[model samples]
Target: MIHAGVYYTPGSLKARFCLAGNQATKTFCDQNNICYDTCGKMLVATSELEMTRMRALWERTAANGLEREWLSAAELREREPNIIGLGGIFVPSSGIVRYRDIATAMANRFQAKGGEIIYHADVSALTEHAAGVIIRTSRGQEIETATLIGCAGLMADRLVKMLGVDPGFIICPFRGEYFRLAPEHNRIVNHLIYPIPDPAMPFLGVHLTRMIDGSVTVGPNAVLALKREGYRKRDISFADTLEILRSPGIRRVLQNHLLSGLNEMKNSLCKSGYLRRVQKYCPSLTANDLQPWPAGVRAQAVSPDGKLIDDFLFVATPRSIHTCNAPSPAATSAIPIGAHIVSKVQALRESQINPGRTLRAARSVDVLHAAFTR
Candidate 1:
């Protein structure tokens, strides 16, 4: 889903990038002939408490300079009869597209520009020197590069550690489980329906979404996963589980969010429990309406003190830059994120070449520009 930058704090990287990315993604889609839906989004409030939160969210959207409209309960019903709510905030710029299509298009473009993507090259080690960095893969292949940008999603922290850098955080996997509504209920809603999220929590509450394929999807409840790649309940890696358990940060996280974590686990196990969460706003849905859909695991970064890193985080060495934490909206903000990384890489390269030169000075000399052009 392409976010409209409604929920992010103003002046943060998320807000800046997401807003820019919303437009960039659409432009890219247009240029690539990729189909997408600017179906919009509604944050529905089911209770007075939620309504209050909804108002705060509305103010936040304004602060973020997003295009939004306040929807009265009657207006909300008029727009989406299937959704029940006290009130809602409609964001017109929110949209949906097949991210896989975008990724594939990007890969094709990269290859067309003489870039190579080696599949199944599991990086085993990284050795950095004054000249460059040497990367060794599990398949016994070694590649040396003048600069390395590590965007390993789940293994970001590990990549930093492989470079002999202390990441100061660990990656905790959170499984977001979804269920596709029955085809018969495809017209359940006209737009993506979201709940007024709790400000304290990072995960947005389970809500209904209108997919680009003309199907409605419900869910994406965040549950702590035992394995980094664990999508199924039974999929557990002993090493992953052991590592998670051993983390002082995760233990602190469990201690703080024990009740909420247990509630998520309960909802995951009990279909009825999960149903109840969405039923508050989408009362028409029942167990029979839900069908299995593929689940996705989020790579959430947590600090040593158990604080969930809610912003885009990057760690830099003289020769490398590691994207340590970037969760939701990262995909939506991919274009700007990539540009941001490129700028960082340029600055790092310049600093290495001329120790006393600032980025502005180096850019004036066109040192990195010459290197790239060469």
Candidate 2:
């Protein structure tokens, strides 16, 4: 995932963790001889209002310790003559790498460091014991651990509920529908190209991404998925649909964001509307150049008050720490985020060992638990 820089608030967990994650990823890639490019990214503004907003974006990047350079219309044209812009922000620190490969490398490193990962072992249930965490898998095998840390992406909220914690949100899957440009048009964009997002929304707006493989991918229109794991249209599971509709949090979120959500839903169905989003910046892209590509589902945590959780949220009970909401830029920030989680769990473990001396620390754990219920 591209670290778009502005989705996270300054000094927030998402911001710090993502900045750290970006640095860690680069170090890992360099050490492992992985191919990556620090080609940077440009957020182009075509209108007068958007140009004014570009200053705020620049300030945000600087506050986050990211290196960014602003470009005038003439300068932007010099950088990419084919692209048109009234103003823009050029982020030098932004870049690209293959996430699947990074996951593989991380898995290997985790195993080498004595971290065990059992594949295909879907967790069926979780029971907290006095001594440790007892995890029951679908295969009927029970495993015990001194402490449990859950990074279960899509199933996070359900896992929290299974542990008897009342998470105030529900996991709603939003599928990102993407299309790849044909080989002939691959040279159209030499770097990442983006449009200034709506100031009121959480989404970064549709943008162009240059993959490490030298292919260009456009779009990723957000649409509510019929299934949590749905990769294509019409892929639905009754249980998944029921789980969403049954949740009061999700219902309220939908009720509140109905207008914006309906627009996304419309784009999902109307190819013409979807294409218009692309045509806004890249006038040269025609519907014929858009081709099917593998899609990814984003597990968004929706609150009962109709708000989407945009930052990283964590909940800790005596037995486990649940990551309820980790959206886009998560993959970019996973390394530091993982380290942060490990630190929290370690701190909790230390408190458990010396409850008398670490009374305050113990209380902090309880606070986390209470937060989960609230």
Candidate 3:
């Protein structure tokens, strides 16, 4: 999904990158002959409180320089007959595409440019020195490089710790479970429908999304996962569980969000309860309309003091840089994010060449292409 820089703090990495990425991604798709849909999206408000929040969000998005249209109840109903709301906001620049396809295209392009990708090699350890970083795989293979950029999503903290850096945070896995609407109801809504989200929470409330293939998906209630990669309710990892239980940060998070977390769990276990959330705006949906769909795990970084890192976070050392936290819209903002990382790497290389003097010959530096597993 392409985000229009809404719902993020102004001047934050997320807002800046998302705004740039919205255009960059579409341009890339155009150049590569990839298919996408700028079908637009709507944030619907079901109650008076939500209406007030929606107005505030409209102002925020405007501050971010996004084009939007405020919709009254009549206008919303005219656009989506099946959706009921007190009011809504229409963002024309928001869109959707298959990110898997984009990733594959990028990998193909990288390989064509002499980049190598190694699979199934899990990195076991990392050692940083004045020269560079030494990466050791589980299979006992060692790779030496002049620079290392760790984009490890779920294992970001562990990778930092392997480099002997104090991460000051832990990754807490939250499973977002989705349900695909039955095919018969595919055209129920003309645009992506969302709810006015709680400002205090990181997770967006349950909403309906129209996929590139024309199917609508409902859900994604955020619930704590027992395993980092857990996709099913039955999947559990004792090691992951033990670590979560021992973390003071995780304990604080649980304490602060106890009620909401319990409600999410209850909905996850009870199909009827889950249906009620979407029913608030899209009442035409029933329990039977929800079909089983694949789930996704989010790697959320929580500070030692229990605050969720709501913006993009990066930590750098002399020889290495780590993307510590990249929350929602990361996929949409990938292009700009990559460009930002590359710029940082170039700056690091220049700094190493001359401590006090700026190096103008950036193109002369040879960036080594190395792969580390996991």
The prediction achieving the highest TM-score against the true structure is: 1
User: Global lDDT of each model?
Assistant: 0.88, 0.78, 0.87
For model 1, how does the per-residue alpha-carbon lDDT over 1-374 read when each residue is reduced to its tens digit?
99999888787888877888899899899999999999999999999999999989988999999989999999999999999999999999999999999999999999999999999989999998878899999999999999898899899889888878788899999999999999999998989999999887778999888888899888899999988889999889999999999999999998988988999999999999999999999998889999999999999999999999888888888888777788979988888877777877888888888988533211111111222110
Q: Lowest-scoring 10 consecutive residues by lDDT in candidate 1?
A: 361-370
- The digit string of per-residue lDDT tens for model 3 on 1-374 reads 88888898877778877888898889888988888999898999999999989989998998888999999999999999999999999999999998888899999999999998888899999998878899999878899999899999988899988977788789999999999999999999998899999887779989899999999999799999999888899989999999999999998999999999999999999999999999999998889999999999999999889888888877777788778788788988888778777776876788788778443311111222132111
Where does model 1 exceed 4 Å of error?
357-374
Error at 134, model 2, angstroms? 0.9
Clash number for candidate 1: 0
Q: Where is model 2 poorest over a 10-residue stretch in terms of lDDT?
A: 365-374
The runs of at least 3 residues in candidate 3 whose Cα sits more than 4 Å from the true structure, single-residue gaps closed, are 355-374
Judged by lDDT against the true structure, how good is candidate 1?
0.88
- For candidate 2, lDDT tens digit of each residue in 41-135? 98899888887777778888888888878899898888877678887888877789998888888789879999887778889998876577889
Give residue 153's error in model 2 in angstroms.
Answer: 1.1
